[model samples]
Target: MTNLLLALIYLAFISLGLPDSLLGSAWPEIYPGFGVPVSYAGIISMIISLGTITSSLLSDRIISRLGTGKVTAISGLLTALAILGFALAPNFWVLCACAIPYGLGAGSVDVALNNYVALHFKSTHMNWLHCSWGIGATIGPYVMGIALSGGGSWQSGYWYVSCIQLSITAILFLSLPLWRRQEPEDYGANTEESPGSDASSAHPRPLKLSQVVWIKGVKEVMTCFFCYSVMEQTTGVWGGTYLKLFKGMDAAAAAAFAGMLFLGVTLGRAASGFLSIRYSDQQLIRLGMILTAGGVLLLLMPGPAIVTVCGLMTIGLGCSPMYPAMIHATPQIFGREHSRAIIGVQMASFNVGMFVMPPLFGLIAQHLSVGFLPVYLALSLGIFALMQRRLASLYV
Candidate 1:
């Protein structure tokens, strides 16, 4: 039963990832069809991010009321319906309208599942589960590429992916019985605390948003999460466009390279899952950060198309471990009682970056040059590294 539940969780992560990069990958084809500038993709992204932030803010209360099982199942259905709307929408405004429910579904599932896993599973499972997400992320762009190259519309791609999401939602609904038996708080109350960590204050009531933010390192942690989101999403959303605009690649090639980025993430997380058995999460995160910095520098260098692709892969590799590691450590840092609320706030912070930064980058690229994106990503990485280090000090 436990193993089956874990498999379902992995599937949920994959479903979570399927639509994430679809907009970005499809945007190059989509904007032209809509008679909009490429920068218009940012508007859709911002709307989605806003919706995600709102849902994340309400996740704790909603999950408490509905339970994680119902929340995941319903969110999956909502996301599927939203994706279908995206597929069938007649105009850009309809696309924007669809983004609302898409964001809401995504944010709630992400928070609920991450909290559930952190409370129930080992660190390695967190890495592997995210790796499953990476697999879906990787597949999305390739699916887009095939649809576009075959003279099919981006709507076809969205339609196909929406069907997959709907299938997953049905499985999630059927799996609800498993969640009732698998609720981990009853089995692993100790999962939230690290050895030698403070436990006396551990059993406090669930935190309000204000109280979670008032915790010592919550602000800094939020900053770190925000920067990470910016780096990851900027690349996912804009990297292909950047390739086409500057590197003289065609749409298909650019999309393939974008898929490579997520493939790198999938591969990197697979390695990190094994590495977690032997190393601490902090050490793994620091290693990822250093590799990420190196990747950014490679992107900034004057190079061939292959070099830029390699750099994107390196960035994905670097990003692979940090997300899961941070999530896994949340309960340890804030206490299990407070983790769901804290993770909800953390998801909100993540969506804030996702909402705000891509459009800001788009405006700059519109006015300035897409070439500057690497510089922007580098700056985000540097700040994120510093924030992660500072947050680490709180534990030490």
Candidate 2:
């Protein structure tokens, strides 16, 4: 029964992750149809991240009040509504307006579900859970590509994706019985912590924003995460447009290529999890960063289609393990009791970087050549590698 329930939850969570993944690929197509400029598209993306940041920051309070299962359901419904609104939106403003609720839904589910899985499941399950995200991310663009290839409008693509979300919501609702019946142990609660302890610590520590712990080696991990977030979000969000504008691919083909990038991430994530058990997290993270840097350099080449795809895949592989490895290492350095808040804070910083970097890339692409993207991405990757040496000592 426990296994069945978990399987169902995993499916629902993956479904939840699909929209964000698809948006990156589909936005270039959809935004133009709505008569928005590339700069405005970047703004829309920033707004979505802002909403995510807000939701994530406030999630502990919301989850405490609402409970994880209820929050998950509400988030799913809101997401579905947002998608429907996006589908029917007649103007760019309406689409941007829809992103508010959409971002809230996405961020809430992401924080809540990841927390839940981390608390309840084993380390291996973390990799599998994220792999599910990779799966959704992979499927989203491919599905959008298929819809666009069939001459369907972006609105039609959104509507179809919403249906998938709604189905996931229903499955989650049906499995609520399992979630309700399970003991706290089923979810990864430490037997040692008192029932009220988590709640007691839930209050925001007087925002000592400047007093953040700057332990040795911690800076390196943070830098790696920051750099990786910038690169991953920038590439994932803009890669489709890059392919279309610079590489001369059409909407559908570009999306398919984007899907390939996510597929590589999916494979890399699963591989990373298995390898982490055998090797040090520090070693894996360092190796991944090096590979990512190499991959970014590959993108700088004026290569054949196959070579370009391989470069994107290499980028995906390098990116795949960084997040999980970072999260895993956080507890080891900071201790488990404080790990959640620290991770949340780290994620906020990462999002800040994610929010700032991509739009700048878009703006730069407007002024310079889109070819400059690989150079910027490569620079970030190199910075991450340099930073990881400092981080390795801290985690060890």
Top-TM-score candidate index: 1
Query: Taking the tens digit of each residue's C-alpha lDDT, what string does model 2 give over 174-291?
Result: 7666666653442244433211124333323322323344544545665776788877878876777777787777888887786566677789889877886677666777777777
Which candidate ranks first by lDDT, i.e. highest?
A: 1
lDDT score at residue 268, model 2, on the 0-100 scale: 89
Clashing pairs in 1: none
lDDT per prediction?
0.84, 0.71
Per-residue lDDT, model 2, residue 98, is 94
lDDT of residue 217 for candidate 2? 50
lDDT string for model 1 (143-246, tens) is 88888899999999999999999999999999998888655342234433322233454434445688789987888889988999988888877888888887
Provide the lDDT at 394 for model 2.
59
Candidate 1: residue 43 Cα off by (Å): 2.7
Candidate 2 achieves a global lDDT of 0.71
